[model samples]
Structures are given as C-alpha cells and as structure tokens.
Target: MAYAMLEKFEKYWGDYSTLLAIVIVLDPRYMMVLVRLAFSKLSIPVEVEASIKEIYDTLVKMYKF
Candidate 1:
C-alpha cells in the first residue's frame, strides 16, 4: 500500500517537474542558458520544448521593434 501511494506520488510529480524547473531557472542573471541546460538534461521532452519555445517566441516578438 505504501509503495503504491509512493508510485502515484512520483507519477504526479513527474508530470509537472519540468514546469517547476523552468520557473526556478527563469532569472535575469542566468537567462536562457540555464533553461537550455535543464532541458538538455531532461532530454528535451516535447511538452517542455513547447513551453520553452513559447517563451522564446514571446521574447523575440517583444524585442523585435
């Protein structure tokens, strides 16, 4: 019973792990470098890629006067 509960907890955590990581790594000092490094470590999961790409695109548009 304990093992089953732990497994479910892990599954739930894994689902949002990348989003949590991105929120942490998003800082002016590190900028995109740490974000890229984190994604590389995660082997570039598709959902993470989409999230990062959205942020990148938004930044590009913002800077493109």
Candidate 2:
C-alpha cells in the first residue's frame, strides 16, 4: 500500500507540483520572489517561461483597463 501510494504521488507530482508552485507564487505577499524561487527549484522550460510571461502581461493589461 505504501509503495502504491508513493507511485501515485510521483505520477501526480509532475502535474500538480507546477500548479502548486504557481499558486504560491501568485500570492500578493510573495509575488515575484516566489516565482523566481519556483523557477529556480523546478526544471521549467523556455516555453513555460514564455507562457508565464504572457499570462502576467495579460493580467497587467486587464488591471489597466
């Protein structure tokens, strides 16, 4: 049972880890500090970085309007 749980954790960790990190980074108190920390910790790709930048730009634009 423990082995099975560990296997499941590994599988989901790939999907959920980034999402969880993003949630933490989105916190107003931490913001870019958390984002930099997450990107440094995780093996984030260039494409993912570009996507994140685009999303941040869109949110900023929305706030301006």
Candidate 3:
C-alpha cells in the first residue's frame, strides 16, 4: 500500500515536475525560491542550475509576451 502510493508519487512527479515548477513560480510568495530549493535537492547540480536559468528565462519571455 505504502509502496504503491510512493510509486504513484514518483511517477506523477517525474511527469509533471516542470509544470509544477512553472505554476509555483507564478505565485509571488514562492517565485523561484521554493522551486530552486526543490531543484537543488535533486541529484544533478549542473542540470539543476541550467534548469533554473531556463525556467527564469521562460518566465521572462512569458511576461514580455
């Protein structure tokens, strides 16, 4: 039961992490802080940094649009 729940969590997290990060950043209270913190916890630091930059740039383009 517990294992199944954890499996579901991992599956959804992997599938929707980018969307979740984008949505969270739309909130002023969180912005990038929470997303950066969460991404920092991931295994790859280099990718984390790149992803952060990409997400920020995407947000900028969104605002400009």
CA lDDT of each prediction against the hidden true structure: 0.63, 0.61, 0.79
- Put down candidate 1 lDDT per residue, 1-63, tens digits, no spaces: 999997887676544444454455566677767776665555457866876786677666656
**TM-score attained by model 3:** 0.67
List candidate 3 stretches off by more than 4 Å.
Answer: 1-16
Best by TM-score: 3
- Model 2, TM vs. native: 0.42
> Could you give candidate 2's per-residue lDDT for residues 28-59 as a string of tens digits?
88876766555545436784576457557755
Per-residue lDDT tens digits for candidate 3, residues 1-65, read: 99999788777654336667889999999989988888777536897788898888888888899
On the 0 to 100 scale, the lDDT of residue 12 in model 1 is 62
- How many pairs of residues collide in model 2? 0
Residue-level error in angstroms, candidate 1, position 33:
3.2
Model 1 stretches astray by more than 4 angstroms:
1-28, 36-44
Give candidate 2's error at residue 32 in angstroms: 1.2
